[model samples]
Target: MNATHTPITAEAVTRVQAHYENVKKLGHWTSDRRFEVRARRGMAVLDLRSPQIPDGDIDVEVDLDHAMVKLLVPQDAHIDHWDLRYTGRGRVKDWTGENGEGRRIRVTGEIRHGEIRVHRGGVATLSAMFSREFVQDVRRARREGTEPTVADPARSS
Candidate 1:
């Protein structure tokens, strides 16, 4: 009989711990399995659902071998008007490598007023670039710093 096994290293454990810590800090966890936050407009809402993540309702996995991360967003959620803005000052080498040859991207999907807007990264490249941008922003914020501001342009003069 032949058997195969995968060993988990200290680094892996640390990564998992860090990921959970970040998720908690991001307000992704709530008292209820799912929580809803009202948007500026009475017509829109932002819902933060949990347990669904552990139940496979949403699959967010990271592959270190491939140096890739994947996130699956549900369709029924009423996420109206989602904008992911990235602004940071960091050495590319700090995140990607010492040579600084990695590309960053950000992609966001929002459904508002019965309309869906999918902002894809790598708009210029054939491949998906949004992932890189999104990952870089998150990692940078966790390591360096982050300034998050919530504003409703529709209500602004």
Candidate 2:
């Protein structure tokens, strides 16, 4: 673990599973998790429906091959898509990682004929991201060093 005091990666980093088929759901990641996923001809969804991350950033790498992945984070999540590489026609739709900032969501990955979609599917309205309250809350959380309100990032079920 890097002790740099950065909430984005302050504590330890956890690597999640790699999917090959079927439908896999990542319930909720409430911490600074280095979520690694590889989906081949399969589907994976980052569904934080009932629960929310609330704070901090998440590091992710998706090795997708002819697969479709949907990232349904909180409407307030700051998606900082740092690295993205694709081959043989890959596409990202409605992904706000390019022009978004809040609780950083650092996403990096490679794909081949795959699609990664990021959407605000939670309770937040379409205009919620631009609200003053949402901005203040995000700033406060970033300043206060908000920790995880859910389970440990390293514990995989």
Candidate 3:
């Protein structure tokens, strides 16, 4: 189980691209205030429930083409994706909408035949649990003979 995880600092511009491949950015990975995601005919998951996230609005610039991108955010997070330009059935599936409080996630960009799904609260936790990364972590823990980070309250060191 060789997983490549990128460390995103508070001042760095984190970018994740998935072209004809699946990309999962989960666990307790730190996140920057701004992100750039490009998904073309592939699947991408960006989990931002880490405590290292800045205390303010988060901006995510997406460029999607026949792809699916899922964002796992904090329960108190308020997502604002109205600024996204859609073409050919591209849309954002957020049931809770924007509640106007907590950390605001501003999404802006163009999508062509793609979708962006937002998971918050318990839904987000479930999404993180039922993932390939989690499976790898569990397997690694069993091999290393130690408690998996998945059992911890926070998925951090």
Candidate 4:
């Protein structure tokens, strides 16, 4: 990944477009500049947004500065049984039980400069998931002896 501080450029636009085309060829229906993906368990919606793209890939400079994911559960859904993990810079700021009702809660946060801060009531579920995925990706790169598209900070040492 490019550094968050970098500005968007035409080269970045080309890269993003290529990635989108590639993914589409593989049969995914992702075409929006911004998209919302619902979790398999119906517990949350992952909102993704980008500022530039010819097709689907996000411009490197157009970082996903904000991702507001909302978790929705049924009346019988068990909040206590749920676990949240947030991996990015934005933090959840407020979680309110609607009208003093117990079955619903709202989660909101802002991401800036690629850092995520989970608000006090925001669950940490997504962060943990992202961290695990990142580690796995690094491990796979090592096993394959392939340089990652993103620069490796450790190698700069």
* Among all candidates shown, the one with the greatest TM-score: 3
**Please, what are the lDDT tens digits per residue for candidate 4 over residues 1-157?**
4232233233411112221111111111223322222221112222121111123222111122333333222222112212233445534333442232222222222233222222111132333224444466567669999643112222212
Window of ten residues with lowest summed lDDT in model 1: 148-157
Query: Cα deviation in Å at residue 22, candidate 4?
Result: 26
TM-score: model 3 vs. ground truth = 0.81
Which runs of model 4 end up more than 4 angstroms from their true locations? 1-32, 39-130, 148-157
Model 1 scores a C-alpha lDDT of 0.22
State model 4's lDDT: 0.27
Report the C-alpha lDDT of model 2 over 25-95, residue by residue, as the tens digit.
43343433556778888876654432344344566788888888776556566666548898898977664
C-alpha positional error of residue 60 in candidate 4 after TM-score superposition, expressed in Å: 18
Residue 18 in candidate 4, Cα distance off native in Å: 28
Q: Could you tell me the lDDT of residue 153 within candidate 2? A: 20
Ten consecutive residues with minimal summed lDDT in candidate 4?
19-28
* Tens digits of per-residue lDDT for model 1, 93-154: 11111221111112232212222122122221211223343354457556767521111111
Candidate topping lDDT: 3
Q: Is candidate 3 or candidate 4 better by lDDT?
A: 3
Residue pairs in candidate 3 whose N, alpha carbon or C atoms collide under 3 angstroms: none
Model 1 quality (TM-score) = 0.17
The per-residue C-alpha lDDT of model 4 at residue 143 equals: 95
Candidate 3: stretches off by over 4 Å: 1-10, 98-100, 139-157
In candidate 4, how many Å is residue 90 off? 16
Better of 1 and 2 by lDDT: 2
Instruction: Return model 3's CA RMSD, one decimal.
Output: 7.6
